[model samples]
Target chain A: MPAEGGQQALNGAARRALDAVERTGRACVDSISAFGYGAALFAESFFWIFRGRSIRQPVRLTMIFEEMMQIGIVAIPIVTVLSLTIGVMLAIQGIYTLSLFGAESRVTIGIALSVTREFSPLITGILVAGRSGSALAARLGTMSINQEIDALRVMGINPVRFLVVPPLVAMMVMLPALSFLSDLVALFGAGVYVSLDLGMSLPAYSDRVIEVLTVNDLLHGLGKSMIFAVLITLVAVVNGAGVTGGAEGVGRVTTRSVVQSIAAIVITDMLFVFVVTR
Target chain B: MGVEAVNSDRSVLVEVEHLVTHYGARKILDDVSLKVYEGEVFVIMGGSGSGKSTLLRYMLALERPTSGSIRVLGRDVVRSRPSELYELRKKMGVSFQSGALFSSMSVGENIILPLKEHTDLDLKTMEIMARLKLEVVGMAGFENLMPSELSGGMLKRAALARAVVMDPKLLFGDEPSSGLDPIVAAAIDELILRLRDALGMTVVIVTHQLESAFKIADRMVVLDSGKLLVTGTVEEVRNSSNERVQQLLNRRVDEVELDPEAYLKRLTGA
Candidate 1:
């Protein structure tokens, strides 16, 4: 028993030493990774701030606009449909549960608050993370793996300006727009359910929602959506640029980016809720 | 053999001294030193995993050395600031092994990316420059095609056009003939030699293709196991008695197809 205990202690000590070494090595790599991402973000932000002056070509503008349209306008129908479906489900559940308390009128308020404060932005962000963020990461990751980023560097073009900036700017601008659109669709769907299914007048439900939901609610949601946009795009760029191993590495990074972005959005939402409520 | 005469010239385009590179715990390049003079086609030849590409990266300032110094165009590439590195890279050009064209853009846009980024040339002027380079590389009229639309050889040509679009004083190519047919590879080798002659540009090529290297290299360096084995003109290298060099240079179909058992028994006296 003593020998077994001693052997177990030795194993634990060896594990601890191994873990300490891994942590120390990974700390350096993490710092390097952080610095690379920081540089990319800084370069992207700088390009956007001075885009009009820096990018003068008409073709470049067309490319930027086309990308924005693909990311924002083309995605609207999916976002709207998904949000509407979610809203309908929430409304049915809310009405059915509230009826047990003989307080079905509160269903409108419930739908309004839930959709506005959490569901709309969260769902929209996840959609964007899965769809747009993954696409961006995969595209850029392939480019990095193929040495196209090195080509840009050799050309004296800041790759962050050329590759990361336009997409990032478009994403930041479009995600908020998508979130706003999603809120409208969700609210409208919820209203439809309340009016037709629950026998409540549209005017009465909307009035009740407006009365309960202040402007601060919309702003808080939008604020959260904006941060989610930033985080998704940042994770996409970091993972994309960090792709070192090839096609499989790109796939892994894209999956990690979407998962990390969604997780970050949820955590950020919690903090945002706390801040807004306080 | 004549290191003193080569060092006498102040027109060294690239100089490396005692370079060391490590990937994780494994050393990839060890104490490597070489000098490339202006207007020379310096070929770096080695088998796979011999750190030929690593040396090119260090020379281009794409990767920093673990120890020792690299000077490219009179600027220290290893320890330069970001802005300094960016500025120094302006005078240089590189064509990667994969061609590395922006897949999203047309060949025309890929060729003109450098002009668009660094120069103040208007659209018409940039277009003209792009056309001129395309014509130079025998890739004229393919500008509107996307990278994905082009064949491997055409992509390499387009990448080469882009690399020389700025009329850089030095050019670096990593495996320029890789993944291309023999005819196309030979054409590329000829184009590289012609470009050197016409522009008087220093060309440093990292390739494992012995035939292509022999055809184009004015001077060649061979690396084995992360260390330089020999460096000399092709004639000197072919005549050398170094066993590894002789083995590598003499590797032909007849030799490789010999019965391994008999050859080993005969060679090893077993």
Candidate 2:
């Protein structure tokens, strides 16, 4: 009887331990399922957005122009200022480092290539993601929480077609345009620094930059900007639609949109480098 | 109960039969059944947490019932294809308790959304239709105003205008009188009645306001604790002998004094 009791106790302990393991495994599976569900929803919504036709042409064009003005024209002064400061610092560092080999002319090519091919697109994407992406997320998130999306659905209007498609199309088309403007400002800033600090004539330094930065370089930067724009907009809309907890959820989605956009931009930039360089 | 006999001649708009819904482990609705005939007002009355809104959603096909069936416009809502559901939803309109207007769009745009989606009407025609609907809802010349600019009563009216912009055959309103003054609520009720009289649309309203339900309902159903208490005309419900029905109708004196937990305990003798 004593032995039987001890065996029963042992079996009970084993059963409890097995149940604990099973419970933890089930919890992990549930979490993974939720994550997969969210990801699938995001993917489906992305396709739905792409499939939608923009109905209001004039309104869509106006929105595009407005977004470009806000993201590109209004952003020029800051980009120019930052580029000039960075150019001056880069020139100073380049001169100091290259003087070890008595090769200061390389500073012109270095700053030109770096700014046009990478820094210009990267910095501009970060700034725009902070401004436009957060705004998009907050606006759409508020709409979701407020049941405006449901209203649109009941009205037999596709909310994605009405709300997201226009903005996404605008972003994709305009980001490349903005990247071109950014590259121009960055090159101009580098030229000014080269003329002042490197003792090179303005025309001569500008000629060298034009030579070093080929059409391939411009295309590469513009391509990255387009990808970054799509990423930012997709993240914004997906996070916005996923928001469920009301005002705090909107705020959380806005923050997540910015952070995720920046991260995606960086990762995509790396992928672009691998492809383009290879 | 013989809704079939009444609807044998006319087209039956919505028929809900043995509808059951569960939220996780809790059954929110149990074997609830009702019919909304054409050109009539049907109201669902229940206290808070009694699954009135769940029933509305089920009727609207926004939610799938765990068991039983709902036939809206003679189509099985639960088993219908996506295209069929979309077409069915186009035939119906819903006005939420919170108005649910897009804050970014002007009142004109909100009204024009449905017209833009389901019709090939030009901008001029759409604008004219929007203005007409706005005027019908007593919101004339408020086209350019944003939703934020409207009062609670005006918002509901605007939402109603938008809801009927498509000229839907059926209208579902959840808590039509909630969060409004009595006067405003009365005005909304008047508008609903006028719409039914003028357009001959089937209306289903989910409300807790006894006065609004009594005033507008041609036929009514009351739900108590996720179970159907009674289905009758306003006078019949008012003169009900059921204790739950009595408690609900008399409001404060009978309801608050008879605590639900104590009643349950006494009934169970535990």
Candidate 3:
């Protein structure tokens, strides 16, 4: 009886360990499956886009235009304001630090490089993640709970093709444009700081910015914005697609969409940085 | 309208055999089997939690059964490929209980959604078809209004318009007359009759409203506690002497006579 007890305890310990590993394995498989679904959705959307007028003209045009207005046009003022503020702040800090070595004149190059290459795209991504991403999640989540998704299926319309593709296409096209706007506004703000605060001429500041900014820098930033846009759209749509329950479920998934978007954006940004910097 | 006429030409459209379903560990439907013949309005009536909607969802291929085969329109929905399923769905339509109209779309657009997706009909033809469906449902002028703008009755009618827009061979309605006044509900019941007459359509309606059930059901099935208690013509079901069926039809709550000894054992966790 004592030996049997000992063997049973050992079996219990092995079972516990096995269960812990199985739990982790299940989580890993779940995450990978989710990613596979997301990638398939992304690829299918691009396929529909390539097919062009296969979708009715008015529907496709209206959807893409509406999404562009939401993701890019409506976002202009805030993105502009944020970029300008960051640009001026960077210039102020750069000049102060350089002035310790009497190199305050180099603030123009510093402001142009940092704002153009990193700040503008990152901030634009985060802002769109909060605004458009949350709205997409909430809207889709509510439709799911209301059985509108099922209605679409019963109607023979693929919900992902009909509802999600336009928004994804819009985000892809708009984020890069917003990033460009951010860079322009930031450089202009920095130009203002250089002329007014640092007692340098605007032309001189422009000259320094022009000298340091290269096509590589522009490509790097714009490329990052595209990646961020993909992250935001895929995360929002995926989280929204999986939503169950009711109104509270919609809210929960909206929050999850925002969180997932930001995390993915940061990780992808790091990968891009490592590639570009190398 | 007679049972013999229906059974004489009975070509089964939806065939379910030994179906079982579960939501988590709790069984919702158990070995329930039924047949829906073409060109008849088959009503599945049950009290709440009796798995009527689960059965409807299975027939619609919205939920998969744990152990069964469901053949809809001669296609095995459980084993069909997605492409095959899509083709099969194109031949049928389902109107959900919630109306399930696209909120962002107007009533006209919602009705035309199926046509827009499946057919290359010109906009002019589509518009005419939408208006025709709306007129049939007694909502002719409500085409321009959004779903949110419609009353409960109007919403149901508009949803019906959408469901019948394609004039599918089989239509599955999940409570078309629920939550409306008797007059409005009666109108919906009549609309179902009109759809059958106009389209030669087979309909499967799931509802708890006895009045609606009696009005349109050519053949009816009564479900009690996830089991089929009776499947017969409307009059046959009305005459059923099954105690559980009687309990449902009369709305009698099953009275539990409790024993203190059993209650004590349950509470003591023995």
In terms of TM-score, the best-performing candidate is 3
Q: Using DockQ, rank the candidates from best to worst.
A: 3, 1, 2
- Assess the local accuracy of residue A45 in candidate 2 as a C-alpha lDDT between 0 and 100: 47
What candidate 2 gets wrong by more than 4 Å, as runs, is: A1-89, A275-278, B2-4, B24-26, B252-270
The better-scoring model by DockQ among 2 and 3 is: 3
Query: lDDT of each structure?
Result: 0.86, 0.83, 0.89
Give the chain B TM-score for each candidate.
Answer: 0.91, 0.91, 0.94
Compose the digit string of candidate 1's lDDT tens values, residues B53-144: 98887887777678999998999887888668778888888999889999988999988888887788899999999999999999999999
Sorted by lDDT (best first), the order is: 3, 1, 2
True contacts kept of each: 0.73, 0.55, 0.67
| lDDT by residue (tens digit), candidate 2, B1-270 | 454565668777888899889998899999988777788899999999999988987887777889998998899999998667778878998998889988988999988978777888999999999999999989999999999999998899999999999999999999977789999899899989998999988899999999999999988999987899998888888888998898889895543576899999999999
Task: Give the per-residue lDDT of model 2 (tens digit) for A243-276.
Answer: 9787999999999889988998999999989988
Give model 3's docking category.
medium
**Candidate 1, residue A6: lDDT:** 100
Per-model DockQ against the true two-chain complex: 0.52, 0.46, 0.54
Misplaced by over 4 Å in model 3 are A1-30, A51-59, B1-8, B261-270
Query: Per-residue CA lDDT of candidate 3, range A74-128, in tens?
Result: 9999999999998888888998999999988877778887887898899999999
